[model samples]
Target: MTTKPYFLLCFVVGLSNPVDAMYYVQPWMLAVIIPLAGIREGQQLLHELYLLKKKSYAHINYHIGMFGSSALLAFALEFSEFLLVSSTSSLTLSVSGIFKEVVMLYLAVEYNNNQLNTLNIVGLVICLTGIIFHCILKFHALQKEKPVNTDLVVTERLLLRRMESADEWSVDGDSNTRRTSLDD
Candidate 1:
């Protein structure tokens, strides 16, 4: 019933697909698309010329500047997201997106003076609590799965000891009597 195997299979298929290599050409695609989009927008603006005529030259220039700046920002954000997904994992990207939303919500509430009703506040708290618990569980899982290094290195002055089986030492035995099977 679990989707984990399906997800893994999809991931493997995605990696194996030769067409996926085209994702690396995203910058080139953007270069071609942006100019085409700009031309389309320019045509739309010309079609709506009457709306532009009422605005002063300075006002038009300021709005155009703001639009261009926002477009550039959008490009930067897209590129960064592409890099993030390429470098890390989809799960990391999803987690970061959630974190970004949380931060934006907090900023809106604190700096923009946006109001959240009781239900919204409660939902946000629950989301944060879930994220915290997820991180704690992931940390513990990783710790448990880590491979312990049992390889021994010899040096001239230092001696290394290896413990025997877990049941070798009896818990009820006195400290002096407690020893590993290797001691015998």
Candidate 2:
């Protein structure tokens, strides 16, 4: 049997995979889709930072060039599921509840601070509630007809917003690498 430390590491790593997968999918989607969703740039940027001067055209243009991971993840999920049609999870969905709660705390605080309009607020609530229900009631549960990338993209987009907001709210960290603050 593996040692306790190894098992603990495995558990922590497993709990973190969803967040990484979700984040890995976000930036690329932001670089591509969210910008083209036909909303004002400043408007969307505000969702990330609570309130910032609207992103300049140049800023948005720069973000468009950063779509690598999102593209790869979507492609992999598609090709693997449809073309290969043989690969499987090989692991149970029994992620730790504590990890889920930690993630939920970040999500809740970000949502509370976001300045979404009435329509967006309504839609976001519906989507978030659906996600919670889906995760709790069913983990591997998926609609066979819809591509999994749809969910990945959505989660990633959300992950970006939450990360951006949290990074902005926190002191002494860059949003990119997410370096944490330290006290002497």
Candidate 3:
């Protein structure tokens, strides 16, 4: 619920993934990384495209609504991915996903007042089937993977997975909290 707990889960999940290693960048690097990520989010490019569309199309309000919805969708996707990765179990992620789909469907019907015809019903069925298959595959894959050894040195190494980019030295703190940087 709190960031402290989420961060602790992040550390655990990061170490648990065998295929992908999660690296914690130095705290000082946040200054540059955060701004760089913000700049690269394509807001300016999206704005320019929207302006071009507005000039070419007669329905300016339509363009505005589309762009606004797109921005909201992007934000939603980013936040959902962050939560999904931070969550401890597949069940939590699956439930949250189902809740999201249900909310979206409700909003669509409420806003448009469109009837769910046979085609729409088929689409919904297919989508639900895909979601079920995805969950099953994910759980199966997780079960097949070898469990990681969460030793003091191993976790410390995992935490500082990509420490070569940072110019710092590993200091002795607690065994679990150690970090190895390029200097070491």
Summarize candidate 1's per-residue lDDT along 1-184 as a digit string, tens digits. 2323333333444432323433444577789998988887977766557657774566677778888998787766666665565554455655776788888898999999999999998998898788767766766776678654532122211222233334455565455346655876
RMSD of each: 17.1, 23.5, 12.1
Global CA lDDT of candidate 3, please? 0.64
lDDT of 2 by residue, 99-166 (tens): 44446656766976745478966876686666666565544454343555444334555767887877
lDDT of candidates 1 onward, in order: 0.61, 0.49, 0.64
TM-score of each: 0.41, 0.22, 0.41
Q: List the residue pairs that clash in candidate 1.
A: none
Give me candidate 3's TM-score against the actual structure: 0.41
Model 2 misplaced stretches (Cα beyond 4 Å):
1-115, 139-184
Candidates ranked by TM-score, best first? 1, 3, 2
lDDT of 3 by residue, 76-165 (tens): 665555556554565557767877788888888899786788998899989888898888887888889997756544555666765643
Predicted structure 2: clash tally = 1
